[model samples]
Target chain A: MSHPEQAPEGRRRPASPTRALAEPPTTRTPETTRWRICREVIIHRIDDEAVAYDPGAHEVLYLDADAFEVFKQVDGTRDDAAIFLELAQQHGETTDEVASRFAPVLAAMRRHGWIGRTHGADEVS
Target chain B: MSTASTIGGRDVGPALDGYNPARRASCPAAPGPESPTYYRIGAVTVCLHSADARFREPFHHLYQRHYIGGPTLSAVHIRVDRVIRARPLGRGFRICVDGEERFLLRKPQAVLPHVEWAINAAVAATLPRYHQLHAGVVARDGFALVLPAQPQCGKSTLTARLISRGWSYLSDEFALIDPDTLRLDPYPKALCIKEGSFEIVDAFCPTAGALPSYEKSWKGRVRLIDPQALRPHRTPWGVPVGMIAFPRYVARPAPALHPLSRARALFQLLDVCFTFGRYRAATLDVLGGVVERAACFQLESGEIDATCDVLEAAWRAHVPASGRPDPADLTRPEEPVRPGVEAA
Candidate 1:
């Protein structure tokens, strides 16, 4: 997986307002490894939004367009760096800019047990 | 077997009209040992056996045309009677089903409200076949419009207005939908007009004066308007839902109709359905089909006429000409008559 520093030239621009607002704090450990969507999470996309129903938790979540795209990419194989790279390519932004925008959202999803870290063994919190 | 009469080309059994409480108590309807008054509300047959004379008048008035008499099975059996000797200070009466007390009436005047409450509870308890939603339902041109809202949202007022203006009244309190087909069944009970909405309903329905209002009840000053009086013809029992609307009565200049996305509509429906948890997957699937086939909207209005206009326009636009079913096609066989004995 490519790191944020290896983002291609010409795609880098000033961070958008959402990226600035969603910027992760430096004290938190960077989530470099790949994250997989929880197997129990069932997602149904309607129009621009997606509704995720977790049978285990009996919880229903509403994911907006950007977050829904991020969730849809969590297939257990891709690392966070790779997911951000693809999102950057799709939205015409640098990998660093996409990472900044999705960093907080991804961390929150990990905390909520919506996604898990895959490092030889699955770890979901 | 009791004598039957054909009303509007449909066979109906003798109503509890001429039988005073004393006469009813002396000779309950036969074929059974005890006399239980049988009344049909749409598809549900309720057998009410109450010895209290106080429950007779209001029960007759509220459920006038719904009485049926034959030898069919009853879906629910409800009994209401005085708890003890009618002392001035004693608790008034108790409503029970299978000897289990559901509610107690504190005064003679509170009998009607308690009976209505008890009947609703009985239906909720006894009948889990159809999925019930906390919504108001009305239909026009072979398609039903479902108004799902929380209490005090002016749902009954709007429903009464629309029904008075020629839209067929299905129900005001609960919208019963078939879990398999998503077709809405009509539960045309008396429209419970609250105190705040009396003026609006009276203006729209001039014949509403004949209906009496019960004061100091559970829902404040409440009046029950018999939908039959407004539209004397036999209305349809079921209709394919064509539209799902969430109405909000706001202090606005004009009525506004905002389109709702399918996801939002589904979420709103799940929130309002009474049996969502019991039939989760089925309810979700049925709701998806309903949302797909129907146009969903959020209506905000203070003016009743304007709101009706908006709904009618939606009906014309969305419900196709070929898709409209005749009212007669939607009517079911006259509610089955059951042998019930009238108790004192």
Candidate 2:
């Protein structure tokens, strides 16, 4: 079983100073990037929280209502901007406000290896 | 057709009669020692062979009432013998099941207590064939009432009181529910009564004075109550669950029974399960079916009588008017109920 915090082998590594500076600013924006859920996770919704069971790690993770909504929207099809827009429409808030509020949550999910870029969905190594 | 005598309308072999611990202790070692006692509790069978005289009498007195004299096959084989070489602490004994050592006690007097613990461990290990939960169970009118609670929550006291008041004893430790048929089987072993509960239980059971009790042990003063003595000639069998109650002992004036949603009940049941994590999805499906069919409650009480009254009423109200199906009919397999996702 793989540790939840450890990234898989052969994945992308941190960019060096020159490569970081060469990267385009638009590519870092949430508008053009889409996310997909990990293939080894099984989620069951309970009340306001969703329980995610990872078979690979034999661990159960909890996601509150807001985080669960974020998880539901990461279906490998929608960009972060589109998910934020949909959630903002439901909560009667602007897309910018929703994005600002959910930025930390999305970062935490990425760090936990629960979500990844949709373009690398098949590259699980 | 067996060489056992009938007691309380049940067959109990002459194992207790032929028991001569002193002679057996002095006799030379044999190539293989055969057990003289056999007992059947619900679906589990126990065969005990002891070379130590100190453990024989208490073992006989504790389980004589629960003896199964007929042709019952033994599933668990236990042998207790004293250590030949003396240590600095002196004589000691070790308990083994099927030739594998399971427990060792420094003092000979601790043999009885260790035997109880060993038997419970053996039973727990054998019950993984069914979905097992840490709960106290009692039944009446074919409707089983499951009381799942944490330790020191007054589950055993309540169970003893209910059984003394005509409720059939199912089990005081584990509720083994068949995963395929969704029926609860009775695992009626001896009920372990703690110190503070002696007076309460003694008042209810007339034969409590004759039962053997160990003092100054780990759980304070403890006594084992043979359920068969309370309800003689009764066969412990499976029954459909009618209610699931989470009991809490509180110092209050009156007892209260609060309704619990199926989701909350499922969560509570899962929290008290013994081996659910090994079979995650299947266990959830089976437990979802259990909570759906059984009404759930949270009971808080200080008085035993009042608490039992509330439970009886709840059982009466929740059970179907057509009554539960016959135990013989419940052996057939049934489809698992779909999991219900209720809002938390």
TM-score of chain B of each: 0.79, 0.78
Off by over 4 Å in 1: A1-30, A33-39, A42-50, A55-57, A62-67, A77-81, A91-120, B1-34, B85-89, B215-218, B324-344
Off by over 4 Å in 2: A1-125, B1-34, B69-74, B84-88, B215-217, B231-233, B324-344
Residue A52 miss distance in model 2 (angstroms): 5.8
TM-score of chain B of 1: 0.79
For each candidate in turn, the TM-score is 0.74, 0.68
Q: Cα lDDT of model 1 overall?
A: 0.66
- DockQ scores for all the models shown? 0.06, 0.06
lDDT of each candidate versus the true structure? 0.66, 0.66
Best by TM-score: 1
RMSD in order of candidates? 14.2, 11.7
Per-residue lDDT tens digits of candidate 1, residues B181-253?
7788877777778888888888878866545556445578677777876666565776888888899889985
